[model samples]
Structure formats: structure tokens, C-alpha cells
Target: MVLMQAEKTAIGSICFLAGPFTLLENALVLGVIAATATLRRRPTYLFIASIALADVFASCFFTTSFLDFHLFRQSDGPTAYLFKLGGVTMAFTSSVGSLLLTALDRYLCIHQASSYKVLLTRRRALLCLLILWSVTIFISFLPLMGWRCPTGLIPPCSRLFPYVNHGYLACWTSFTLVLLTLILCAYALILLKAHRHETSMTSLQGAAGTGHARMRMDIRLARTFGLILLILVGCWLPALSFMLADVFVILTHTQQRAFAFCSTLCLVNSAVNPLLYALRCRELRVALLQLLQRLCVIGRCKKTTQDLPPGIHFTEEISCTAITEHEIPTNGTMQLHSVSEMVNN
Candidate 1:
């Protein structure tokens, strides 16, 4: 139950270092999406933006509360502790939900290319996000709403005991496991469908060029999804398994330390998500670069916008025009330009 001084320092140091980096990475993803009007209108980017926003909160709340509880040992009331954990729970739950929605978006893009846009309109995407966050908030705060540990018996409750309810943890763990399984199945079907398309194209005469292009897109998407699955399983499965175990058996000190490490690994996923989903897209990369460049220009120029150099104005105009002129490639039945261009068409 108690971590050694060295163990505490080690875990705290990792959280301290990784927390800001995670926050900054996700924040940049959000900034790029917000700055790019073209990306803002699509359901895909909206899901991605939702993930980044949740990660931003996750990084902030988890790092602060974790350090407070484990390292600093802040003397806080039960209500305050529950609030911190609820925030962490809500943020992480929303993140996982958004990821599931993103996978569904990709599935529709591949399987229902013709009606992907109609199926997932921007308004509908926003509504899904609203409902996801609403449900996540309610579920996360159940412990605070009279679901805490019963009036203390002998040995205290498990890991998140006395603050978070065991039943809630079990249910949440089951939900996460279900989400991971669904994501795996979704990607499996996508790959299978792509394989069928490739085989059909190869057998057909005069459709090689277009079919090959679409196949290449599918393969690239498969690779990206593979990486995502790898990370998700690597980062989450251990912690989730541990939590599930904790629900049944009281974990030893060593197991507790391992769980702590696993929890930190989960935070690493938040940092890497932008790389897998956002920066991999050429459009988002360009937008991020332009956003950084604009920030640099603004930092260097002390004068007002009207007093800026004409060349800077010209550069801005050209960048704007370039972004506006960029077109989604529509070849065969697939109209994807990049990994994150699912709903852009």
C-alpha cells in the first residue's frame, strides 16, 4: 500500500516530465484543427479534436492529483479527492469514447464511402460528442454521488478505495475492454474489406490503376490502425487488467507499484495520439506548420497587423489560397487524401 521514497520519486518524476509534454502535444493538435477552417467542418477532425481536448484535461488533472496524492500527500477532504479522480475519469473516458467514434468514422469511410458524409454530418458528430461527454461526466462522478466505500470495516478498500467505488471501477473496466474489442473488430473488418477490394481489382481488367491507388490508401490506413491498436493494447490493457484483478484480490505493494507504472503508461498514449492521428495527415501537418509560422511572425513583429511587412501579408494570402485550393482526391469509390480525410469529402 505504501510506496518507498525512491519509488514515489520515480513515479512523480515521470508524471512531472510527461504531463506538460502531453498537454502541449494535444493542445497543438487542437490549435491546428481550430485554425484550419477546412478541417473544422469535417466529422473526422471533430472526433480528433474531441480526443485532444479530453487528453488536455486528462494530462492536467491526472498529473496534478496523482502527484498530490502520491508524492506531495496533500491533506484533502474526501470530496476534493473524489472530484480530482472524477475529472481524471471523465477526461480519460471521453478520450476512449472519442477514439471509438473515430474508428467508426474510418469504418464508414471505407465501407460506405458514397454516404459517409451523409451518415456522419457535422451536426450529428457534435451531438454524439455532446452525449459522450454527458454520459462520461455522469459515470465518472458516481463515486462522489454516494458510491464511495462503505463505512470502513477492517482493511481499507483497494487501490482507489475509500474514494472510488469498486463496483464503478469494475463497470468502467468492462466498458473499456468492450471499447478496445470493438476497435479491434472494426479494424479487422476494414482490413478484410480492403483485401477483398484489392483482390477484385486485380482480377478485373482495366481497373488496375484506380484500384491500386485505393488499395494503397487502405494499406496505409491499416498500418496506422495497426500502430494505434498496438499502442492502445500496450498502454491500457495492463492497467485495466490490474484494476480488474484489484477488484477481486487485494494487490500487494509490488503490484500496486506496477499499477502506478501502468497508469503512467496510459498517459503516454495521450501524448502519442496526435502523432498517430493528426500529424500523420499531410493537411494537418501543413496547418500546424502554418500555425507555428504565424505565431512566430506575430512574436517577431511588435507592430500592429496594418504595420506588418507586405511580404508577410503576401505569404499569409498564399498560404490561405493554398489551403483553400487543396482538393480531396476522389478516385474509384474511395475519396481519401490522407489518414484523417475521412469526412472531408
Candidate 2:
């Protein structure tokens, strides 16, 4: 009841905040994809793109629960709503699974550059995502296997457990710990490799082109993701431990609210990934901005090109060997250009 009331008063707050959060994330992503027009050309963005979309879905999912209870009176659905089965498990599996694969993609891109082409292809990304979702689905549904639902109940969330939810207890605990450990080791390897990379470059002449920049960006991404993994673990660990302790001894209502509160912290991870990648990876930012600019041009030119039939148009969104504004000397000018080819019959 307390949680429900708190959520009610918080609707305006969530809408004001989470809505814009979703928009910027969505625009930056669709702008990239639309401007690129071809996925193969921008393979570096594949993982982030996938995760951003998944984050959007995740935000929608969790918000539904809050909105349903807070905004709608029981008389509106009261008993006939489909909201219960809509959000929770699907959102969890996709969001969490997406993060895991995001790390795996980064590992492949950084560690195995030789076959990064062959290994992290689009099909491979889709297949990995499918596998992750399949596993998440299997585990998320485990609670349903033994539990029975009480009929005519709105939301069907209450009476979800005969006792404590042992299924949830086991799944979230093991999954968070294992993923957090693996993400740590993967990032540690990236840092070690980055150290070796920097040392091997003997001169300023050697540190040229996108190679050095790419390496630095990858290292930064690894560090950011490592922090994200830590945050994921940190956010969930308290709640997880508390829940497990409930099995040993009864938990007070205060303890349950504390556990519930912890889940909201995951939203921070969902919120910030866009800013991190945009700010950290120089080439990606260039590509993204170039894409946006190209889209604006296309928008302006759409009605003017009447002589041309329905023909395909291509503008380059890929910009390699970029020196970001921060890196350039105060007196030096940063030269940035995109190589574009317009295709017409």
C-alpha cells in the first residue's frame, strides 16, 4: 500500500524525466541507423544500438507496473486488465540479456580484432541475443511452473508466492554474481591488452590513424562497462542478500520496502549508457553527428528532388581517423570530413 501510494504521487516525476531520457536515447539511435542506411558499414555500433533499444523496452516495462497501479482505478480494469503479464519478465530478460551480450561484443571487438569481422557479424549478434533471451525466458518462467494463480484478482501480483519466491531468489542471485564476475574479467583483459598496446607503439609516427583512437575508445568503453557491471551488482546485491536472508528468518515490512527500492537503481544504468558512448568514443560521436546532419539535409532536400524518381540515396556516416575537439591543441584546427558517395542511375 505504501509503495503504491508513493508511486501514485511520482507519476509526473517519472514522465518528466524518463520520457526525455527515452527520447534522446531513441533519436540518437534511429538517427545513426537511418543515416548509415546500411548496418554492415557501422559494425562498431551494433552492440550499443541493440542495448539502447533494449533499454527503451526495459524502461517501458517497469514503468507500466507503476502507472497501472497509480493512474488507473480498480474500477477501470478492476478485474479485466491484461497488464499483469505484459511487462515484468519480458523487460527483465531483454534488458539484462542485452547487457550481457553488450559486454561479450566488446570483448570480441577488443581482444580478437583479427576475427572481429567474422566473429561479431550481424547474424552472430542476433544469434547471441536469441540465446540469451531463450535462457532468460526459461529461468523467468520457472516460478510459474510450481505456483498457482488466484483467479479474479487484478494484476495477479499478490499471492504470487506460497512462501517466499524461491525461484526468484535463486535466479537473480546466481545470474547477477556470475555476470558481474565475467564482466570484471573481460574488462581486466581489455585493460591489460590496452597497456600492452600503448607500450608497443614506439613513436608519435606510430600512433597514427583510427587504430590508436579505436584502442583508447575500446579501453574507455571497457572501463565504463566495468563500472556498469559493478553498479548492476551493487544495486541488486543488497536486495538479493536481504531476500535470501528472509528464507532463514522472517523479513519485516521495512526490509521488503528496502528490497523494492533497490530495483529502481537499475534505471540509472538504463539512463546513462547513451551519454557515455557518445562522449567517450570519438569516432562514434563523429559518425553519430554526421548521421544526424545528413538526415537534416535529406529532410530539407526531400521535396526538392522531384526530377529524380524513387531512387536510392547514400550519404557517408562513417568517419575514420578523427581527432576530437578535446584532443586538438588550443591553437590547432581540427579537420573532420566524411567521404560520401551519391548513388543514382
Candidate 3:
């Protein structure tokens, strides 16, 4: 029993520490996107703003679960119910759903261009956002309303009763599998279309420098898109696979770890998008640098204002000090001069 408790404690601690990195990464992404927009003269990222909010809500579960188990010395005190109901269920689930929406948005933007704007307009995105949040909240609230039981347990705090394991994993698994299959098929078709266009260009131009250059550009773009697809698959597959396995075979302790790891990986994946964008897209990188500098300047100004002495009379003596240091003298003495004060040392 003691050993088991210790193991849980250790795992929980690791989880809490690792989870915050997701927040930091997301925050950086938000900064980068906003900075890029201002520097490049584009609009700010309303999408990133939503994502940042969701990630923060998700942390209520990610951070608290770990701290309750590993950080707090108290074995029991204000946990389980509050954290699971308010934190884990609401925050984490909404975050995951937001990710699904994000993936679908990107997929549509790349593959189904003709209807993209019409279907994925501001109104549509907002509607989708509302629906996703509503669903998550409703699902999480089912237990409290006595419609369904909870799912799991934290030591001496909250416990989740397995309600419908078959539907639990099967539903999400089937939904994801179907959606991903369609997404991949669409991407494949899009690639084929791009290739055909390139071929016609090549035929017309006889593979000149411009045609060759376009071909290379096409290949690089395809590679970048492919990377994003692979990341989505690699991060989510483990958890989905475990959910499937749980339906047929027993989910051993090892499998539990794998599922949990997958969940964590997906969370980290949300934070990774901006980094990948910056690395694969040059424009993104430049924008990111600008945002960082802007934020730094803003931060510096705020700090300076906060630190300013009281009543310096806004326009005191305005003297500019230009300090110059002469090269060390032959005798190993240093020379310093201030232009404004005309002082020598």
C-alpha cells in the first residue's frame, strides 16, 4: 500500500511539472502570433486568444491533479469532487475539443478551399466554439445531475465510477478514426491536384529556373503539411488505441501509463504548433521576433513607470550623459569622460 501510494505520488509530481510547459509554450505562441501580426501588419490572432484561454482552463486540472497528489501534504482536504467536476472535466475536455476544432479548421483551410470561407467564417467558428464548450460542460455535468456516474479516482479525494466504458472509448475512437480518414483522403486529393498543376506549369515552361523553383516550393510546402499531419497522428494515437483496447482487452497498469502519456503528448502538441510554424515558415519567425521585442519594450516601460520616484516633476533637468572610455593607458590606467558633465576620471 505504501509503495503504491509512493508510486502514485511520484507520477503525479512528474505530470504536474510537465503540464505547465504546455502553458508556457502556448503563452509564447500567443505572443509570437500577436507580435507577427503587428510587425507584418496583419490582424491579431483571435484563434490563439481562444486557445490561450482554453489552455489556462485545462491547467486547472493538469496542475491541480498533480499538486493535490504530490505537492499538498494533506491526504484529504477539498479535492476530488471540486477538482474533478470543476477543473478536470470542464477545463481539460474543453481544451481537447478545442484542439479537435483547430485541427479540423486547418484541415479544411488546406484541403477544401472553395467552401472554406463560406463554411468556416467568423460566425461559423464562433458557433462551433459555443457548441464545443456547451457539449463539454453538459457531459461533465451529467454526473452531478445523476444521469451518469464518474470515471476515476484520486487518493483520498475524488473518485470516478466507470459509467459506460464501451461507449466512452468507442464513441471518441470511432469519431476520430472517421474524421482522420476523411482528412487524410482530402489531403491526398489536394496533393494530387497540386502535382497536376505543377506538371502543366513544367510542360509550358520547359523546366526553366522558375518552373524548377516552383516545383521545389511545392515539395517543401507538402513536406510541411505532412509534418503537421504526422504530429497529430503520433500524439493522439496512443490514447485512442488504449481506449480501443480497453473495450476488448484489459487496460493494464502499463496501458494506463501509455494512455496518460498520450493525453499529455496531445496537450504538448497544442503548444508545438507555433514553434513548428516558425521553423517551417520564414514569415512566422520574423513576426515572432517582432512580438517578443514589442512585449519586452512594453514590459520595460511598465516596470520603469512603476519604479519611478514620486514627484520628480515630469520635466526635470534634461541632461544627456554620453560616457566614453579611452583605451587603457600604457601605464595600465583607465580613462573615462562624460560629455554632458565634462567630468574626467
Relative to the true structure, how large is the alpha-carbon lDDT of every model?
A: 0.81, 0.56, 0.56
Model 2, 1-345: lDDT tens digits are 234567545653654477468657755664565556554355456656666766676567665554554355433332223334334555555665666666666777778989888877777776676777677666655545544234432222232222225445555557766775676777677777766665566343465675667677667756766676576677556755775665455556566655555555555566765665434567666767787676686665555454444564323322112334575553122212211123412
Among all candidates shown, the one with the greatest TM-score: 1
lDDT for predicted candidate 1 compared with the true structure: 0.81
TM-score for candidate 3, please give it: 0.65
Q: Is candidate 1 or candidate 3 better by lDDT?
A: 1
Candidate 3: regions farther than 4 A off: 1-17, 31-44, 66-120, 140-144, 147-165, 182-186, 208-215, 277-288, 298-312, 315-345
Leading candidate by lDDT: 1
- Decreasing TM-score order of the candidates: 1, 2, 3
Error of 3 at 301 (Å): 5.1
Worst lDDT 10-window in candidate 3: 315-324
Regions more than 4 Å wrong, model 1:
151-156, 206-221, 296-345
Q: Encode model 1's per-residue lDDT on 164-246: one tens digit a residue.
A: 66677799899989988998988888888888877777677557487668778777867877888999889999999998998
Candidate scoring better on TM-score of 1 and 3: 1
Candidate 2 residue 277 C-alpha distance from true site, Å = 3.8
How do the residues 257-314 of candidate 3 rate in per-residue lDDT, one tens digit apiece?
A: 4455465665565556545533344665666676666678678756754675553322
